[model samples]
Target: MKKIIYTMILAAGVFSTTACVDELDQTPHTEITSGDVYTSAANYKSVLAKVYASYVIAGQEKGGGNKDIATTSGYDYMRCYFNMQECGTDEMASTWLEGDKVKDISYLTWDASDPWVSDTYYLIYQTIDYANEFLRNATDDNISKFSDSDRALIKQYRAEARFLRALSYYHAMDLYRNIPFVTEKDEVGSFTPPRYTSSQIFDYIESELKDIDGDLLDRSEAEYGRATKGAAWTLLAKMYLNAEIYTGKARYSDCITYCNKVIGDGYSLEGDYSKLFNADNQKRTNEIIFPLSVDATHTVSWGATTYIVCGEVDGNSSENPLTYGVKSAWSMFRLRGELTSLFASGDKRAMFYTKGQSQYLDTGIDTQTNGYLMTKYRNLLDNDSVASNTASYGASIDFPMFRLADVYLMYAESVVRGGDGGSIGTALGYINKLRERAYGSTDGDVKTTDLTKNFILDERARELYMEGTRRTDLIRYGKFTTSDYLWQWKGGVKDGKAVNSKYNYYPIPQTELTANPNLHNDNY
Candidate 1:
C-alpha cells in the first residue's frame, strides 16, 4: 500500500520555526506520528469516533475535572430541562444563591488549576487535525475499500468534522472571547497567533460553516448523527441571532432568514417533547440536529451518561437506570423562578424535573440533598432488553446539540428584532407548531404571539432549559446580568446579578494571561 501524505498548509504559522525561534532554537516535539494507528483507514475512523467521544462525560467523580464540565449543566449555567431540587437554597453552589458561589469566576485561574480548560481547547483542535488529515490523505484505494455510498459517507464525516470545529470555536468564543482561530491541522500548538476579536471569531465560524454547508446531506443517514444542512443552518441562525452581542451589529433579519430555511427544510416538532430526550427514543422525532448518534440497539455510547446515579442500599437512587452517581459534583442548573412559572399550569414539561427533590435516591450519597433531578436526560431503571423492548439501549442515551424547537424560538426572536410581517408570521408559525405538539393540540391558549425578546427568552427557557445554550442565551440577550424586576438576575442571585457589560464576556484565564502577556482581561 502506498503511503498517503496529508499535509495541511496553514497561514497561521502554527508549527513554523519563525514564530518559536525566540523561545528556543531546539527542535519541537511532534505529538503524533505515522505509527500503525495514524496510517490506516479503520484506525482513522476510530480516531474520529474518539473525537466525538469527548461529548461523553469523562469525569464522574468530584475530584476529577468532570465536575467542571458538568457544572455547565448546573443552575449557575445552562438549565434547559431544569431540575429544581438542584437549585434549592440548601446547595451553596446553586446560581440562585448570592455571593461568589455561582459567580462568573469559572475562567479565572488560581495559579495551578487543573489544565482542563487548556486541555479542552487543545483536544478539540487535535480532533480537527485528525479529521483534516484523514480527509486530505484518503486515496482511491483507501476509499475503494468501501462502496461508493460509504465513500460519500466518509465525505459526510469530513463535513461533520468541519461542523465540530465550528461548534468548538463557537463555544470557545462564548467562554473565552479572546481566542486564536485556527483552520488547519498545522495550526496546532501555536500560541502566538493574535486572538481574534469576538466579531472575527463569529466571522470565522460563519465562513467555515458556509464552506462545508453544500457538502452536508439534506437528511441524515441511519446511525449518522453528524451535522446536516439543517443543523448548519440552525447554528448559523443562532450565530446571527447573537450578531448584536458578538459583533455589535444587528443581523436579526439574517437570523430570521436562516431560521426559515431550517424550518422549511422538512424538520418539525416531534409529537411528544418527552421523546426528544427519552433513552429509547434515540433519533426520536423532533431532532433537527444533535451531537450523539444512536446505534442499532438504541444505546448512545457518547451521550451524557454522567447524569446517572447508582441505586443506594437505602433504596434511594436517581431517576436514571444506569445508577452511576452524579459523576461530577456538578449538578443540573434549575430554571429561574421566572422561567419555571412560564409553563401553563398543566404543562408536561413542568414534570421534566423533580424540583426540591432529595438527592439521596439511587445516588450513594446520604448527607448531600436538595435541588431538582434532571429528568430530561434521566432514564427508567431496569428497562426491558432491546430484543424484548421497542427501545432498549440497556444504558446509553444520545444528546441533542440542536433541535427544531430552537429554530422556532430563534425565528421568533429574529422577527421581533426585524419588525417585519414575514418575520412575525414565520416566528409564530414555528412557535405554534411547537405549542400544538407540546400540548398535544393547539388549544386556544396554547400558542401566543406576544413575541418579544423577553417572551422568546421565556419560550427558550421553557423549551431549551438544560440543553447547554441557556447561559449563552442569557448573556447575549442582556438577561445574564439583568438586575431589573423584568428577567433580572438581582443582587440576591449569583455574582450581584446586576446587568453589567462585563458580565457579557467571561474573564481571560489567569494562566493564559501569564503565558501571553499581550492578552487582556475582559474587565480591563
Candidate 2:
C-alpha cells in the first residue's frame, strides 16, 4: 500500500481553477494545456492524487495560500459537510458566533444563500469535475505510450476516478436532490448541464457503481485512503438503504445484498472503539473501509478531523492539554442533551465532558459551558500518545468515511426494514457485537426481541455519534423535521421544535443557480 503524498503536479493549479468555472462560455484562467500535464503516466498519477487532494487540501499551495474556493473561510470538503451533517442534527451544537451561518445550520434556519451551502455545493462539483477531467485525459489511448505496469496502474486510476465521481454525485443527490449532472464526456465551457431528478441521479450512481465494480481494487488490496471494492459496496448499500428517500422506492433487499458483499470482504471491528477515531487510525486499516487521510505534517489543513478535534474540546476541562494532542482548543462544538441521553452510564462510547458544561442548552446562547463537550475524536493515539505535531491549525487524525461497524448497523436496519435474503438472527448478532465492544463485555448485549426498528435507530446514534451520519439517520427515521425527535436549539428555539418537512433535502445553492441558468433551487 502506497502512502498518498500530496505532490504538486505541473498543471494542478490550472486544473483546480478550471474545473470550478460556472459559466459555460468562460475560458479557464490558466496558462497550461491538458497535453502538457497528461504527457506521461507519472503526471497522470499526480493529477489523480490532486483529485483526492481536492477533498482534504483547501488550496493549491498548502496552508492558507491560493484557495480552491475563496468564498468561505476554512472552506474544505469535509469541514463543510460536517457543518451541514453533524451541527444541524442532535449529535452536535456550536457556540462559535463568527456568523458563518453555522447558527443557521444548528437552528435549522438555513437557506440557499448560506455560505457553507454554497461552499459544499461548489466543493462537490469541483471534486466531480476534477474526477471528470482525470478520466477524460487518462484514457487508454492517451496513455498508450506508457509501460505495461504504468498502464495497468492508470487503468485502476481511471476506475478510481469514476468511483470518486459517483461518490460526489451521491453526495449531491443526498444533499441537493436536484442538481446539474455532468460527466467526462461533457465538454467544459461548451454547454450548461441540465438538472437531473433525484431518481435519475440515483440510477446513474447505481449504474456507475456496478459498472466499475470489477475494475476497482479488491477491498483487501487498496492502499489507505484510496477507494476499493468495499468502499463502493458501502456507498451502494447506503444508496439502497436510503433509496426510498431519494427515489420513492424501497430497495432494502438490494441494500442487504451489498452490505453482505462488504461484510464478506473480511473487514472486522477494531477491538477498542476509541482507537478507531484517534490520530493513528490510519494504521488500523482492518476496520476502516475508506478514510479521508489527514496528517498534521504533510496533509495539513483546517478541515478534516481538525474540525472534530479542536471544535469539540472544552475550554475548561480538567484533562491535560496533551490529552487532546492539539495546541489549543477552539471550544466551538458540544453535544446536545438528546445525544447524551442515548448512552448508558456504563457505556464507554459516551465520551463527553460534563464537569462544567450542562447537558441542557438554555436560551440557545453561544457560551462555552452551555452544552456537554465531546471527546470522541481526539488527536491522541490509543496508547495516549500525542500526534506528531501539536499545531492548532492542523491535526494528524484521519476521518473514517466508511467502516465495518456502520456496515453491521446497516445490515441490522435493513433486516428490520423487511429486507429479504437476510436473517433477523444475523442482524441481532451484528448489533450485539457492537454492544460487546461498547460495554467492554457481553453483559450489555441485547437479544432478538430487542432488535426493533426504533431500537436500531437509537443504537445507531449510540454507536456512530459525531461521525457525520446523524442527519441522514434522523431523516430516514422520519424524525428530522418532526417533533417526535427534537434537540436543543432546533428550529432556532431553545426548547426545540418541529421544522418544515421541505428541509429534509437542502436547497441547491443560490450562487450556483445564479451562475448556471440550468440549475434551480428546491422549493423549501
Query: On residues 18-81, what C-alpha lDDT tens digit does candidate 2 reach at each position?
Result: 2324421123446777877886767777788877877787775545457765665656888888
For candidate 2, give the lDDT of residue 220: 64
| Candidate 1 lDDT trough over 10 residues, lowest sum | 76-85
TM-score (C-alpha, index-matched) for candidate 2: 0.95
lDDT of 2 at 428: 88
Please, what is the whole-model Cα lDDT of each candidate in the order they appear?
Answer: 0.50, 0.81
* lDDT score, candidate 1: 0.50
lDDT of 2 at 62: 48
